[model samples]
Target chain A: MLKKYGIRKGFIAALFLNNSIDFISIFFALIEIGATPIPVNMAFRAIELDEIFSNADPHAVITEKDHLKVIMKYLSGRIVVERNGGNFLMRDSGAGGFGRGPAEVDHSIATINYTYRGYGYPLGAMVPHIQYLFGSELLQEAVRLDAGERLLVVLPMPHIFTLIGCIFLPLIYGITPVISRSRNPLRLFETVHAYQIQNILAVPELYELLYKFRDSAGDCTPLNAFLSGGSVMPDEMYGRLVDEFDVDLIHGYGLTEFTPVSRNIRGDIRPGTIGMVCDGLEYKIDPCDEFGFGEILIRTENMTKAYYRRSAESRDVFQNGWFRTGDIGRVEDGHLIFKREKKKTRKVKGNMVDLLEVQRILMEYPKMRNAIIECNDSILSAAVEIDSARNFDSEVLSIKKFLEDRIAGYKIPKIFSRI
Target chain B: MKDNKITTVDADNLRESIIKTLAVIARINEKEINDSILIKDELGIDSIMSLEIIANIEKRYNIQINEEDTMNITTVGEFIDYVIHIINKK
Candidate 1:
């Protein structure tokens, strides 16, 4: 089908669809054909999708049936294909194709992983296939996921956290990952209890939802350990999962450019720190200037070469075989301590404030669904989605006090509105 | 000197091409559309598709349509009028 569309080697193919078993085959097939795959987040609305389409200029776009209509509109003068997902993935290509050893499909540029999180324009890092192998193997060595480990994957497929933790790690260790198409939290918990699943890897939000409804688990649950990344786990939730719920929860660190960078060992961990650096990678922190904080940089054996279509931008960071992560952190007691994300920080009244740090603190607040802080035209404001559990006006009042208590007054958004 | 003649083209001919293109885009027949149809509701012309239709019109007519004007034209008939006005102005 790609050949019919005139997509040759060294071309870019946009993978704009939700998570499913089919995502695995389509992703590898594109890699096997030597074309780089750019996995577009399915949750992006029109404006966000428009930004990515212009940024990556793909030769062809493969999307789910429902996403076809929307994705086609964004693509101009481009080939589009639809995938039905799940069992249809295993069905023959209808072309009756040929062969290549899975291990031999290495060292080629695999994907331009879209890792941007801020409200700004999307940016992708060019990751080679070797990075995927090294990162996944590093995880397999640390976690020791046995062949019998029944893990349920809940995070979105496009995220680096999910790709390393759920997909590649399991495949490398000969463990079968239970890929669920359902997005409902209830169905996920049901799958865990019903399937006798052992391990879970998810973002902090999903863990919080399960914690909120802990009674749903009742007495008998098959879950043994939980691994979390993409964000720091709140202390309250961490304690509840470990002390009350009797599940092992560990904090891991990863970025889209390189994943499974560092993950806490099963039994050895410390609070307020993202675990020790994984094998085959070295990390360092710059000397603090007038403060106990410095930027974190890493020299990895298999880190991405540069940003896609933005070589000059990468030059500012990738120098002397060291990649400067725009993350501010410090080393304390031999563990990496996260201070704030540099990209999301803004200067307010001569003080630097991290929007992501504020968003993380505001997300788990009472009656708050989600909080997004953005700097638009040099003005910082927060769009807080208030849960309908309480009166809208009253929730706004409580949220102000909540922000005042947790963050600096200058860091608080000048305008707060319910989304 | 007489070679530059602005031959007035047939309005129905241009309108026919527009209708056919719209039918192909909406995946419906030209018979289903008329002067009173709301493109947003009847044809499901989403925001991105609206830009796509504008691009198609520009390609087919060999002319450029102002994007700002395209946003305000909601109905199918209005889109046709906007294209005709741009061509006639030339």
Candidate 2:
């Protein structure tokens, strides 16, 4: 079955897939045969996908029957979509010679997952096998997986955190991480009850939604704890999960480059802090302010050195083998308390909104002259400037409507200003 | 195009504007804000988003939306009706 498709030692395969068993199987198969699997986010629209397609030029793309058209529209390479049957997909891709014969592990690129750039282009962080070893070991111990662990997954497959926390770690730990396609809380509730899911991996945005649907799912579900990262979990939402459901809400912190740098340990929860640093990772606070708040710098064996094809940007962040996390935090009593971001980025409803990115996009609007975006109290505010002859006040709604077609909803600035 | 005088907002305009504001604030499509759809469940509008909608409503119409008016809004139609009523009084 693995006899085809010219799979070289460092073959970069872009996987445009949904959260299904097939997605997992293909990812493992790609790795088993010495091919680097790049997980492409399924939520991307044509414009965003165009940007990514240009950035990560892959050898091949493996998607599902539903997403074949979208993938084909952008990519001009060997494309494979899994049919309903298992053996069929294998025969199809293999007969096409997608696999580069016997798999051998050596010095080759492992995987490339993109990091969101608010102001700049998306960075494809290249991870090596050694980094994967450290990441897998760190996550397995941090998540506290048990032999009887049945994990529920709601996040996308392509994300670095999801790749480790949901996919790889479960495989290594000998557990099937139950993946759900729907983001609706009711569907998640059904999956949790049906599978008796004891561990769940999600982002803060979904956690907030689950908190809203707590009443309907409170008694029926069997979730022991939920491991969440990606955004700062609001203190109120955190307290509600703990107090209302008696659930262990673990807030782990790390970027797409590497994660589990720190996570709130079970039973020793801090509502606003990104828990104690994960074992095997060393963190240093480059003091930047008088209040002991500074840029969080981490040097871990598992960290990726440079962004794929982004040498300059990679050099900017990864200096002296320490990744400058652009986040401002203070260590208090063993917990890393995040103050604010040093970079012009903020979390709005759990999505990282880059102010510079927003401004750059804003400038593209026909009437837009210049703009400044700020995140105040988690509410995005944009001060837009236009040609003096045009009324900025009247263009506010139109500017926002224009943004709707371009950026995500959470990235939309709430307060519109004219300067 | 700019004016200091407050333009009279009719019921239809008020209703449309409020729904549009909710859609923008909640990050949902304007069509999703159908009259009877539960704002929280269907549109993913939480308490924070509702507050954002209220603030936007206030700012857009240049009127102070009292807490009682905001508390009464459940569905999109109800919210539009509430905003219209408040604007009429103002």
Query: Using Cα atoms with residue i matched to residue i, what is each candidate's TM-score against the true structure?
Result: 0.65, 0.75
Task: In angstroms, give how far residue A36 of model 1 lies from its true place.
Answer: 1.1
| Candidate number of the best TM-score | 2
The lDDT per prediction is 0.67, 0.71
lDDT of 1 by residue, A126-209 (tens): 887878888888776656667877888877788777787787888888777887655344456668777778788877656765
Off by over 4 Å in 1: A1-7, A85-107, A117-119, A219-221, A290-292, A345-419, B1-90
Clashing pairs in 1: none
Q: How accurate is candidate 1 locally (lDDT)?
A: 0.67
Q: Evaluated with DockQ, which candidate comes out highest?
A: 2
Lowest lDDT 10-mer window, candidate 1 chain B? B1-10
Q: Model 2: per-residue lDDT, tens digit, A1-419?
A: 42264555556677877777877877878777777777876655444566666776665677665666555565444435444533325224333434334222234457777766454446777877666667767766756778768888888787778888887788778867887866656567778888888888888777776776666574644778888988888888888877765668888788877777788877677878998887777788996677888999898766787777777888888889898888889888878988778876787765666677678778988867788888877777878778756565447656765765465556667777777
